[model samples]
Target: MEKVSFVIDDALAFIVRAPLVTPFRISTGQHDELENVFIRLHASDGACGFGEAAVATHITGETVAETLENLQSAASALRGRRITDPAAVCREFAPAFADNHAALAALEMALLDLSSRVQGIPLYRLFTPIAGQPRLTFKTDITVVIGSVEEARATARRFAQRGFDSFKIKIGKDEEQDLQRVLAVREMAPGCTLILDANMGFSAQRMLAFLDRLDAGGARPLLLEQPVPKQDWEGLAAITAALEGSGTLVCADESVGSLASARRAVETNAVSAINIKFMKSGILEGVEIARLAAANGKRLMLGAMMESALAITASAHFAAGLGCFDFIDLDTTFFLKGDLSRSPYLDDSGRFDLTGAGSGIGVVPELP
Candidate 1:
């Protein structure tokens, strides 16, 4: 086993123009551009692995300063360790930061990226065996942020023309306004799958009323994500039951942050699906949570947090192995200025294909 050592080379923060298709508003922001944080981890062998922490202080309470502090602290613990096994490295460094999942995820991802590079195999191939190479298809949802009904309808029409069949609209700002927006979107793109992500901006009663309005408007959503607060398991369950068989499934994104929370949600039947994100639960932990969701008979959706190409590619590698997620939202990199890499994973239809021949994510050109 090679004695693994890593150095925290540089941390870069960039303000990216993440314009929503509509004015996206959650409990977090009404009109905001995404602030992305990128961490670079360099191994002793000159192999570098990158990790991303897209911060939304209002959503996850993780600020750039706090994330950097946690990464620095975790980086110290990761030095001079023989990390021949990526999964073992994750296990070893996970507890170092106590309950800081975001920081721990950064460390684990760097180690995995290094390990795959060392073995001369892509991270997806390292994780699972491919039988029949399937074309990795992902359903990216066009975001409809809080906006006027006419704006929402126009946005829906634009996305429909772009061949996106799924739409995730931000709701819970106003009952009448949101209903109009939903109705307008439905009218514009009647065939597209609709998803509502409230981002915990509504109370249980308000959420129920909104769901009721959706039902009455004949605008059934494919899923409702984080309608209420994360801790309101009872409310989530009630909403789930109320929407049972209404062609509107409920998925938990903020609530299912950890494996334990996923298990709890499964035990209490709080959601119909789990939204798995590498940004939230690291790649390895996200994989474990996906397996747990599979075992518990809950479908999974690999979600993203406005990451760069490196992080999004890493996530695509992970998602390639999991053949169960009914939906995928890996379009974060598409919104970047330029992917900071050469030879990025590109498919025929702009989706990433993981079956190509290469090692350590297949492409590690100098950061562009």
Candidate 2:
């Protein structure tokens, strides 16, 4: 095997407009737009890999300034390291730059992209069982962030009209208002599957009451994501219990931060599924989480952090290879004005094809 190494070849950041038609609040207030960050890694052998840092201040406590600082620190560490294994690079630098999950994720993705290229295999094939299953197709939930019932209903109608069959609504603004929003969307798009993401904005009492209302209304949610804060394991258990056998699955997104968290969530039966975001846990850790979820009889969902096409397409490849994710939320690229890379993933009927081969993710468009 050739000795693997990485050089801090180039780094750049750009601001993009990710405007939401609604206010987009849950625990926090309105967010008009999101700041996006992208990173590039060039190997000594003329191979390059890409990653993204897409974040919101309310979601992961990462702002544009802090994310940039973390990237700079990672870039500095990459100046002269002889990285024989990309995973080792992550293991070494992750602790040094702890708490910056977004930054760590970017570097880890770039390394995986480069490493896969070196091996001439897709990143998903490296991890998943590829024997009997056809290449996976990903379908992400279209989000209707906090908004009026009318606006939320309108958003859901638009997305459903655009071939999206799954919908994720941001709730926890108010119990009654959330109910109204969900009801409106259900009424507008009767055939679309719905999931509620509270974003850690509810208490145990609020969650139970809200579930009661949803049950009474006959609106069966596919899953309830992060109904309580990450620290409130007991609350999550309560929520899970209340919805058990009701056909409403519970998923943990914010609560399952690492492999350890995944194990704990399983041990405690906190959720029925896990939402794996490569931006939140890096590729290796994300894979580990998926394995843990599968071992525990829990399903997996590949979620994104509002990334550009480069990052989202990379995730699409990963999701395609996994073959175990019950759902997908890799549509972050749809919100971008223009992606830097060409050959982005496209699904005319809400079904994406991941037949590309070789490493460094097969869909990277040439940068002009």
Candidate 3:
């Protein structure tokens, strides 16, 4: 394949507000709407690519204002740069973006998208060599955010009716209510795989007790995600050890923000799975982490923050192209209030297909 190179003629960043159908609550906070940053990189050859930065203050500590400011500086630095290798550019810019992973991801995503378009190939082709093959489709899990038991049940039923077989339930607020919500969701979505995400809401002992209760009720989830705080390595290791033979995997989310953190988590055996989010690891680092996790035999899961289809589609292309993730949590787009125009790869069912997309991410969202 001939390499296509082009100078970045223009770079721009803007804010996009996407409203959710309902307030999505986690242990740390709640979101009724999302204010995120979007990036557009225009190549000298008239090709353009898009990216999105979903700002989660609780997770990445990046606000929209700071993200925009940082992006402007990055845009200034990226202009006139010849990009034959987008991933290499991303790595080159890593040091400067140490404090802002989401912004870096937006830049990397835009570069990759633009490069793929310049080559007239789907975005996944850039990653197929690493994956060993191409993946055509992937199923995603829908999240039932922290809410009342009735609300959870209703959400589960609605999604089940829509052919969603995997459910990620947000818990770790009120112990009793959280348990009730889990059980209610289970009742509504029978035989479905359940993933419990606490978002750093519990102590090790408390999380164990909650697990015991779930086991007693025969509703043990398939995975327990980030029950302890992000920096609580001791708590995470203890919980992982306690769940060694309990048929549940301990997955790290907030704890693995960078490649170094992910390496530490794997070396310490603190968790059995790693949750890879572009907003946390950026695109290149996320791929490296995925490779690292796979090499170390750690289960891989791909997730997204509160984002529109534009960002989710980019993630979908990456995941589908790589074909390595064991669990898919790219359901945030389903929570957005509107048509699925931004996410052309996603469908009414919780599935993403990249076969139909054209060059690049194959999604040009109608941003307002």
Q: Which structure among the candidates has the greatest TM-score?
A: 3
lDDT of 3 by residue, 55-140 (tens): 99976778889888888888888888887767777888888878888888888888888989999988887774345677779999
RMSD of each: 3.9, 3.0, 1.6
Q: Write the per-residue lDDT of candidate 2 for residues 1-368, one digit (tens) a residue.
A: 23454554554443444554334455565455556666666666777777667776677787877777777777766755566777777788788546778777777777777777766777666555422453555666777878789888888788888888888888987778899999988888888888998988899888878878887886778888998988999999988888789888889998987889999999999889899997678777887888788877997888877566667777877777767778887665555444442334556335676665456676554432
Candidate 3: where is the Cα deviation over 4 Å? 1-3, 128-131, 339-341
CA lDDT for candidate 3:
0.87
Quantify all predictions' global Cα lDDT against the true fold: 0.68, 0.73, 0.87
Model 1: pairs clashing at backbone N, Cα or C within 3 Å: 23-145, 23-146, 24-145, 121-359, 121-360
- Candidate 3 shows a clash count of 0
What is the C-alpha local distance difference test score of candidate 2?
0.73
The per-prediction tally of clashing pairs is 5, 2, 0
Expressed as tens digits, the lDDT of each residue in 1-368 for candidate 1 is 23434443433222333443223355456435545555455666677665656665666767767777777665665565445566776787777645456666666666677766766666666555222443354545667777778878987887677777777887877768889998898998888788888878787788878778788888978888888889999988998898787777789999988888999999999999899986677667787788888888887777776555666677777777555677776665444443342226753224556656466655442432
| Structural RMSD, model 2 | 3.0
The reply for model 1, stretches above 4 Å from the true place, is: 1-24, 76-81, 129-135, 340-343, 346-350, 362-368
